[model samples]
Structures are given as structure tokens and as C-alpha cells.
Target: MQALYDVPAPAKLNLFLHVVGKRPDGYHLLQSIFTLIDWADTLHFERRGDGRLARHDGADAMAELPEDDLCLRAARLLRTESGDAALGANIHLEKRLPAGAGMGGGSSDAASTLLALNRLWGLNWPLARLLPLGLKLGADVPFFLGGRNAFVEGIGEILHPVDLPAQTYFVLKPPTSIATQEIFSSPLLARSKSVAIVAGFPAHNSSDDKNESLQSTGAEVVKLDAQGVAKLCGGFGSNDLQKPAEAICPEVRQALQLLEARYGNSRMTGSGSAVFARVSSEEKDGMSNQSMATMLQDLPGAWTGKICRGLDRHPLSGWA
Candidate 1:
């Protein structure tokens, strides 16, 4: 195919992020459930035989996108890795997701670029081949390439696919942005002991034996179905970075308070300023688009909000 149009790069929400430890290299080890949501940025790609790669801003594009955008990085990396200097693409990105919101927007876009270009160039490289290349771009890139809800660990490279229940979430993005480096480098950030999870989350304070925690949780973990996954939503675990992120961007705190008051449970996703709340599927079903619109009417004029649903798989799951 010479062209791919309107390809999707979906965003992700961290159900819960816990800093388990730090590597000798200073990279933090973490455990979290990275769940895909319907909110996405769109990309269009056209193969260029002349071997010239270019990027364009689509509707609502972010202002001042860096010259070395992830899409370009991904394309160049793929070309270099595949040894196909003749391969090139013109990529147009529709930047819907807010940067620095901990939504994995850029990483997702990069992953999508790799997937689309592989097919365009007839590389037909399997996901395993693409994964290492993706890792070089960013920690979260592999998760998007894996294309499923996953239990992620080890600076976001390790992924174990988990079936997540279908559910809707109210995702709110404050005007302010929080840098991931800032949160990770903060002296005040909490590095918690790894929390164990089975089919369900145990009480937050449980102190079970580490070996037993893994063994007992292992069987039940594999057996967890959609209903089981749904129960864990808004109930288990917490974001370790939330406090630090809120301190850095007060709007994060304000957004969380607003959602928590209405939705009972809300937390910052990934490392920053965007927060999400679990909304009942039934409640969402009963409401019209206009009703959903009014739900966020009270949000600050500078902020943006969306009612998004969790996806079992990324839209490009089978492409690799």
C-alpha cells in the first residue's frame, strides 16, 4: 500500500503506578496497569519513493512541536534498522491528546508510525523485531506496540497482557503540564514497596510474604475475567507520583478534587496533570452526548475533558 489514512494512535491511562525500586542507572522500576482508552490522535502516512521523510500539522495540532518529533524519530529509526534507505513517508499528525499529560500521546504516535511504515514499506517485520527499536525511542513505546491492556513493570519495558473490563472514564486535562523528568527527579516522590496483586487487589497495608504474594497471586491473576477486572477499577492501588505531580502543577490537584467530588475516586494517570475517574457503564449508557457534555461544563475554561471508554486492544493490534 502506498498510503494509510486516518490511522489511530490511542492514549493510555495508568490504572495505578507504583515505584517499586530504582535501578543502579537511576531509572525507576515501576508496576502499573496501562489501559488503552478511546481518546486518540490520528495520523496519515503516504509512502515516498524519493526517501525524504516529512511531518505536517493536522487540525488542532500542538503549537511548537519539536523538530525531532517522535514520528520522525520512529521513521528514521525504522529506516536505519531495516537498512532500507529508500523508504520514506510523509506523516500528518492530528494532535488531539495533550502533551505532558502522562497520556502516552507521543509514544503512541511513534508506535503507530512504526506499525504503519512496516506495512507501507513491505518490511513485514514482526512485533518482536520492532520492539527493541521502539524501546530506543521511549519506555512506553513497547506497550503501544504490544497493543493490549498490560501489567507493566521495569521502567515500562516489561509487559504482561491482562484482560481489562470494558468501562468508561471521564478524563480531564488541566491547562498546566507536568514533566515526567521533573516528577521522577523530585526528592519528595515516594518510592513504595511493590504492591502484590492477585485476581483482586488485597488490602493496601497487607504484608504478605513476598514469595507467597507472587505464588498465590499467579493463578488467580491468570483467571481474572472482565467482571473481575471491573471490580478493581476505582478501588485498588494508587499512583505514587500523584502527590509529587500535584505539588508541581496545582491544576492537577484542582482537577482531581473536581472529579473526586462527583465520581468518588479519581487519580492522576502516569506521572502528571491529566486525571481520570471511573464512570459506570450503565450511567454512561443512559446519558446522551449532550448530557456528557454538561458533565464537564463546570471545568475551568482552559481545561479539556472527554468521556472515553477502555479498549481491550489497540486499534492496530494485528498489524504487526
Candidate 2:
């Protein structure tokens, strides 16, 4: 029996997202650096002769996503594109990350499926071919396929490889999930800032190169060495959707405030209800097992949390 087991679909955080403008199609123009994290959902696939796609875990039994799952769709798309009928696999997802926390769980899952099936089916589709299909899955899906750190832009499809500092983070998800589209459409959303682009990474938060309208009022400069980068992920980086998300979900606001109080540099990831803090690498060694336990114990009765390390690369490509 040809089988592949324990493939990783890693989560990601947008270190910072700047909305340059909106396109004619109503998609927002964005510029951000995305880094993969070690926190992941695992998939196990066993080739089946019967050609049926099955998911044994991860998704809720009543969650209604199995029928519309990107994982299954990815497999189907690959099969159709390659014109192969003898390929099939039984997928078992070991879901660890929370859904809709803006952690890219589903997109990661879909990308992993595309990769695993490409190998298992022996079709040998190049990453470029797999990418357009993955875009059909999610904007974030293609980044995982790129398999390296990137400066992403243009509704999250265009990608440019970047050399990003490696780091670890403590990501905390509140009890609620914020819908991505709703956050984008909020009337309270700040969208009038002049679209500005910096030539290179600024010194964590000097904002000297940023336009006045695009600068955060509370921004602070931070120094991140390799070790410091591994621990505390630079300074208090900002996300465009955070304010709107917080305005709609008080739980998200509370999560950010609490993490900031303890960790100093805290912010929400993606279109979040999840907030994270930059812990110094030295501090990370001290907490390895104890910090998560301590933080969870202290968390409000209504939240879910985890300690996620920043990755200089996506997890799946380590397989390639």
C-alpha cells in the first residue's frame, strides 16, 4: 500500500499589512511580509484503489465544510488537470489550529493536499501549475507553495521572495472567530491613508520612511537580532484589519490588550480574533513548556491559545 503520513500544513502571520488601495474588482490591494510558523495541522494519506476522497479528522462532523473542503477540491482539481483516474487517497487531518482565527489553517491544509497528491499521484506538476489552482483555494495558499519568505502584494496573489528574520511567537485566539470579509467592509475601518511603499524594511518601527497618514500613532522602534528575532518577533507591528476586527469583537481587543500588558509587543495576526506577543528568544528557552501552561492557566475562561514559533520557510517544502 503506497501511503504518505504526517504531512504538515503550517500556519502563517502577516508581520505587517498595508492596504495600498482597492482594485476595480473590489479586492483590496495589500503589501505585507508573511512568515510561516511551526504550529500546524497534520495530514495522513493512504492511497486507495477505489478512488474515493475521505477525510477522517480535523473538520467538525457537523461543520459543513467537508463537502466544500479545499483539501478534497484540491485533489479533485489535480486529478482533473492531470487526466488521471487511477489516483486516489484517504486523507486524515490532525487539526490543531483553530478555524477562522486568521491563521491560514484552511489555506495551509489545501496547499498541503495539493503537494501530497502531486507526489502520491506521480503527476509531477510544477509549483507554478499548482499555484493557479491553489489560488482557487485561497489567496494565502499560493504563498505556502512558494515555500519561502515573501513580500506579498496585489490582493495576496503576487509574490516576491524576501529575506526575513526568523523568530518565535505566542499566538492567542479568543473564543470568537472574526469573519475576514466583514472586517474588510466595516464602515469604521480606516481606509483613507495615502498608499505608501517603503523601499526596504524599516528599523522595526521608526516610521521615518512611512507617510504621516500611514504611521501608527503608538508605534515604537524595536531591535531584533537573530536570537531576539527568534524570541520576541520585533516590535508592535500593526495590521490593517485589526482595529475593525476589535471594534466588532471586544474579545479580540481584550486579547491584544492582555498580551501587550504581559509581553509588551503584542498585535493581532491576519484578519484576527487571535493576538500574539513577541517573546525574546532567551525568554522562549525559559518558557519552552512552562510558558504555555502558565499563559493558558491565566487566560480568561473563554479563550484558546498557543505558542507558535516563526519560520523562515514554509513547512511543506522541507518535504520537497
Candidate 3:
């Protein structure tokens, strides 16, 4: 195929994040469940025979992006790593997910770029082969490359696949963006000493038998089925970064308050500036899209909000 059109780069939510420990290298050790969502960025690719890589803003959403955007960087990295200088592509990104919202947008786009180019360039590299290159781009890149809901650890290089139930969420993004580096470096940021056990979380202990197993194993078991997973997530865990994010940006707190007022429970996803609340099945079943929109009619015009459904796997999960 000479082109790949309407390729999806899905976003992710850290259902729960914990700063279990800090590495000697200054990287923080974490435990989080990374779940894919319906919200995504669209990408289109056309093969170039001249081996010249180029990028364009398909939707004008990426007009300000630099030449070193993750998508382009991924392309260059793959080309160099594969030693295929003759392979080239014209990439157009339809940016949808907001940048710096801790939604894993850039990382997802980079992962999708790698996956698409793997096909368009005829390299056919497996996910395993591309993983190290992806890690070089960002910590979240490897999770997106994995294409499944995962229990992530060790500065995000380690991943253990976990099945999650299909569910809906209301994700709200405020006008302001929080710099991840700023949040990480903040003196006010909480360095949580309490390590989280997978079984101690709601989604991880959905069944009595599973709870029994966890108790017997001292919460060492780490895998769960889809139903159990669905029961486990959806505003289930805390984000250790939320306090610092709010301290840096009041908009983050505003978004959380708004979502919490409606949904009763809300938490910041990833780092900051974006907050989400789980829409219970009973509520989702009773409300239509129009009704849902009406409920959120009072949201600030400057803010962006969407009702998103969680995905079991990445759209391009099998592509690699």
C-alpha cells in the first residue's frame, strides 16, 4: 500500500498513579494502569519514493508544532535504527487530543507513526523490535506501542498487560497547560512512600475469589480479566501529582471542582490540566448524548470537554 489514511493515535489515562520510589538516576518509580480511550489524534501517511520525510498539519491543529515533534522524531529514529535511508514518508497529523494534558497524545502519535511507517516502509518490525526506539522518545511511548491496558512500572519501561472493562468517562481540559517538568520538579509534589498493591485497588479486586487469591499471595498477583478490570478502574485511584499540578495552575483545580460537582468523584488524569470522572453504567444507560451535553452546558466556554469511552486495546494494537 502506498498510503495509510485516517490512522488513529489514541490517548490514554492513568487510572491510578503512585510514586512508589525514586531511582538513583533521578527517574521516579511508578505503578499505574494505562488505559486507552476513544479520544484520539488522526494521522495520514503517504509513501515517498525519493526518501524525503515531510510533515504537514492536516487539520491546522498542529500549526505551531516544531519539526522535532514526536511523530517526525519517531520517523527519523525508525529510519536510522532500521538503516533504511531510502525509506521515506509524507506525514499529516490531525491533532485532536490536547498537548501537555498528560493524555499521552504525543507519545501515542509517535507510537502510531512508528506502527504506520513499519507497514508503509515495508520494514515489518515487530512491537518488540520497535519498543526500545519508542522508549527513547518518551516514557509513555512504550505503553502505547504495547497496545493494551497495562500495569506500568519502573519509569514506564516495564509493562504487564491487564484487561479492562469497557466504560465511559467525562474528560475535561482547561485552557491552561501544565508543564510536566514543572510538576515533577515542584517542591510541593508529594513523594508518596506508601507503595500500592495491585490487589488493593478497586478494579484489581472485583471478585471474591480474586480477593482471596490476592490475600493468599500477599497481593503479589498482578493480572485481571476484563470484567474485573472494569470493576477496578473509573476514578478508582489517586494521582500523586495532582497536588503540585493544582498548586501550579488554578485551572487544574477549577476543572476538578466542576467535574466533581457533577460526577461526585473526579481526579486529574496523568499530570495536570485535564480531569476526568467515571460515568457509571446506570448513568450512561439513562442518558443520551444530547442529555449528556445538556448536563455539561454550564461548563466554561474556554474549557474543552468530551464524553469518552475506554477502549480495551489500542486501535493499532495488532498492526505491529
Tell me, by TM-score, which candidate is best.
1
**Which is better, 1 or 2, measured by lDDT?**
1
- For each candidate, what TM-score against the reference? 0.89, 0.84, 0.88
List model 1 lDDT by residue over 1-320, tens digit each.
89999999999999878787888988887878889999999999999998888888754533334647899999999999988798988889989999889999999999999999999999999999999989999999999999898778778887777776677899999988887899988887887665555443333333455511321133323434545444455556678899888878889999999888977778899887899988876767788988877877877888999999899899999999
lDDT of each: 0.83, 0.74, 0.80
Whole-model lDDT for model 1 versus the true structure?
0.83
Q: By TM-score, highest first, what's the ranking?
A: 1, 3, 2
Q: How far in Å is the alpha carbon of 112 misplaced in model 3?
A: 0.1
TM-score of 3: 0.88
lDDT of 2 at 158: 78
On a 0 to 100 scale, what is the lDDT of residue 215 in model 2? 27
Q: Which pairs of residues collide in candidate 1?
A: none
Model 3 lDDT tens row, 57-81 = 7664323346578998999899998
| Model 2 lDDT per residue over 193-249, tens place | 444443443332223335532222121222234642333243423577888998899
Kindly report which residue stretches of model 1 are placed more than 4 angstroms away from their true locations once superposed. Answer: 59-67, 199-231
Clashing pairs in 2: 231-279, 231-280, 231-281, 232-278, 232-279
Task: Indicate the worst ten consecutive residues by lDDT in candidate 2.
Answer: 214-223
